[model samples]
Target: MAPILKISGLSKVYDSGFTALKSVDLEIDKGEIFALLGPNGAGKTTLISIICGLVSPSGGTVVADGHDVIRDYRAARAMIGLVPQELTTDSFETVWATVSFSRGLFGKPKNPAHIEKVLKALSLYDKRDSKVMTLSGGMKRRVLIAKALAHEPEILFLDEPTAGVDVELRRDMWNVVRELRDGGVTIILTTHYIEEAEEMADRVGIINKGELMLVEDKAELMRKLGRKQLRLTLHEPLGALPEALADHGLELGKDGTEIVYTYDSQGERTGITTLLSDLSQNGIRFKDLDTSQSTLEEIFVNLVRNQQ
Candidate 1:
């Protein structure tokens, strides 16, 4: 099947000679959760804005569900639903009224039942009649999600959807997102929280300084880039590593009472057996040992740093 969203050589520049995006290319599959990871000012939002028709690109093109985003604006936009990072809904209107209005704005015929379903899915049904101003910040965020879903869009873009929300609400929103994906909605999420991406994304894309560094399947990325470490709590403090242990490439901890051995998981030989045998020969003994593997956050940070 063709990609649901396609961006080719996309670039964006500001009036001040600031390039917000480089020649970037990306494709989002249908019903998959793609997490866009980046530091602030990395063009995540700029890329999204261009696809949604909120911002013009300096070069290249975007297609959403086979519709040219620029030439066929209405058709492309109708397939997308965006939940912005900030809350910008009308404060005077009731929750139900605002959500209903949003769907109407998209030229979608009035469907009270669909509106009710959206509200209820987001746990906003009970607050349907409440004014936006009276709702809490978290509730307001939920309202934003409800509005986005009111039109039954096929593709959803969530920009930091869980930001500022409590743990419970965040989990609740994650469930909603999964349900949407299960129901055949393609989701693209940008988040500062690496844990969120690790927990929810089928694929991860990393952007830094307006350039897309890499995009890969979440599991494949971890398997290819992840490293493991073995920490040995030394039986005795070592002033310095002995010359015999130089081949191990071990790092001494601050306290000198611990040593760490880092190795690649993809390597054929971990060298753990040799290192242990050498330690025994050198009269070095470990009181205890612990092993750990690199997390998605660690891999992400390393990739961005290496790109810079």
Candidate 2:
């Protein structure tokens, strides 16, 4: 099957000689939750803007649901729902009216039943009659989502959807995103929250300095890059690792209370058993031991750093 969204050699260069995006290429499969991870000014939003037609690319082309975004702007845009980072809405407009108006803007026929369903799906049914200005920051963010869904777009773009929201609201938004994906909507979200990507995304894409660094299946990415650490609390303080144990590359902690051995999680021989035996032979004992694997955050940091 063809991809739901395709971007090829997408480049954006400002008149001032700054290139915001450089020969970026990506393919988002239908119904997949693709998360775009990047730090500030990394072109995450710029890329989204180009695909959504908010900004025109200096080079390359984008196809949304088989329609060229530039050549078929109307049809292509109609198939996309964008929840921008900023909460921009008509403050005085009641929730229901604003959402209904958005559908009309898309040239979609007024379907009150469909609007109701969208409102409820976003948990805005209770506040349907309330003005947007009266809602809290979190609720206002929900209003943005409601307006995006008003036209029933096939692809959703959520740019920092939970940036400043509280924990409960953030989780609630995550649930809504999952529900949308389960209903067959292709979701592409750009977020700073690594845990969010770890919890929700099917695939991960990392960008930095206006370039696409890497894109891979989330599980495979973790398996390929993840490292494990074996931490041992020493039974007694040691001045230094014995020469016999030096080959293990053990890093002694502060005050000689702990030692950490780093190794690849995918390795057939973690060297844990050998390290322990060697420690005994060298007369170094440990009080307790534990192991930990690298997190998505750690992986993301490493990717960005390596790209730089």
TM-score of 2: 0.94
Residue range 68-150, candidate 2, lDDT tens digits: 99999999999999999999999999999999999999999999999999989988999999999999999999999999999
Model 1 scores a C-alpha lDDT of 0.93
Per TM-score, the best of the predicted structures is 2
TM-score of each candidate?
Answer: 0.92, 0.94
Per-model lDDT: 0.93, 0.94
Q: What is the C-alpha RMSD of each candidate to the true structure, in Å?
A: 1.9, 1.6
Error of 2 at 66 (Å): 1.0
lDDT tens per residue, model 1, 122-177: 88999999999999889999999888898999999999999999998899889999
